[model samples]
Every structure is written in structure tokens, then in C-alpha cells.
Target: MAEVDTEINGYIVPKNSQIFVNKWTIGRDSNIWSNPDSFDPERFLKREIDIRGQGFDLIPSGSGKRMCPGFPLATRMVPLMVETMIHNFNWKPKKGMKPEEVDVSEKFGVALQKAVPLKAIPIKL
Candidate 1:
């Protein structure tokens, strides 16, 4: 691994070097993902994988010992937020739409988000 790193040192770069990590490409690598462009959350459901950063295959927060300190917080916050939304209401498309038909285009910035805000109807449960 060290020799490989040294060999590619000029082509690729370390954190302090001129080169930088292209997180977007890494996240959407077709070689690692089944349908890299698709937003199939189900792909992760049955797997023992998680977004906890330890598993680079699906590290939403990041990986390694220097990973996000907010990982545990986000872990707690995300599911709670989803649960709250699910328990409080039912979400559906505007009309004549299905989950699979939902567009998943992303816009990049400090963080990525849907290019078009997901328009869904929320009915009080």
C-alpha cells in the first residue's frame, strides 16, 4: 500500500499536497456501486453496512479515526427526525407519481441537495 501510494504520489496527492479529494466521484463510482446514479435506499436496507464512516463502502459522514465527531449525533438525529415525520404524517407525491419515478438529481455545494426540492404531500396521520 505504501509503495502504491509512493508510485502514484505525483498523479494523486496526500491531504497536504496540491491534489484534493473529489468526494463526488468517490461516492458515485460505478465500480463500487451497483447503480451509482440511482437513489435506491433499499440497496442499503438488508446489508450489514451503515453510514457510520467505518465502512467506506457507505460512509455518509466519512471514515477513519479522524472522521466526523458529530457522527453519533447525526446518527441519533437522522432516524429521530425521520421517525417523527413518519409518525406524524404520511408523505406522498403531488399526483400520479411513484417513489421510483421521483427524480434524484443533485446540486453540489458545501453539501449536496436535490436540484429540485422533493415536492411531496404530507397528510396528518
Candidate 2:
């Protein structure tokens, strides 16, 4: 809800009116992203982009004053955890399945989750 009345793109938005920002639409807009539907983390490495809300293209943790307080901790912890897991174990697909057979389809809702739960056999190093 907006605390004060504001004009946005020629429309007068009244105070206390609920505004829904469609982040999903923005994320997949063809005008903004090339091959928008594809998962490509390497694109970030190729481009000079910031994720801490500074770059409008990607704001996973959000941006500005309303951004998440735990963004810093999450960014650090998530990578560390992933690195540690990869380093400590050898992961293989369960039931003699090949790595390529794993389903990466997403079940989208309030949060995006794997359509099929992934089962992996972890061999400790």
C-alpha cells in the first residue's frame, strides 16, 4: 500500500492503494533479456551487472530501502554452502539414472520449485 498519493506514468495513484509489481513479467520480457526463458548464469559473468539492487536487470534479493536485510548474509552463505557441498561429496543421480535424465522443470507459484523432486546419491569424499 502506498503511503502517499503519486503519479506514475501519467496515472494518478491514490494514497493507500495497493500496487502489484509483476516481477516475473519484468524478468522474462524479451526487450530486456535475450533468450529470456533460458537459464544462463554465465551471462552475468560476461556482463558488468550488479545484483544488490543497483542493476535493474536483476534484483533477486530486491533493491532500494525496501530490499531484504538478510541479502548480504544469504548471498555469502548460499555460495559457501554450495561450494562446501560440491567439494565434500561426489553427487550422482539415483536409481542408475544419468545426469541428463534429471528433470529441471519448474513448478511456479509463490516460489519456483522443481516439478519433480531430485534424488541424488551423495558419496562422501
Indicate which candidate wins on TM-score: 2
10 residues in a row with least lDDT, candidate 1: 1-10
**Residue lDDT tens for model 2, 1-125:** 56788898999999978566666777778998889877776867777877788877777777888688999899899999999999999999998898777776767677456989999999999
Which segments of candidate 1 are over 4 A away from where they belong?
1-15, 95-98, 111-125
For each candidate in the order shown, give its overall lDDT on alpha carbons.
0.73, 0.81
> Candidate 2: lDDT over CA atoms?
0.81
TM-score of each: 0.64, 0.70
Model 1 per-residue lDDT at 124: 100
- The RMSD of every model to the true structure, in order and in angstroms, is 12.4, 11.8
Q: Give the count of colliding residue pairs in each prediction.
A: 0, 0
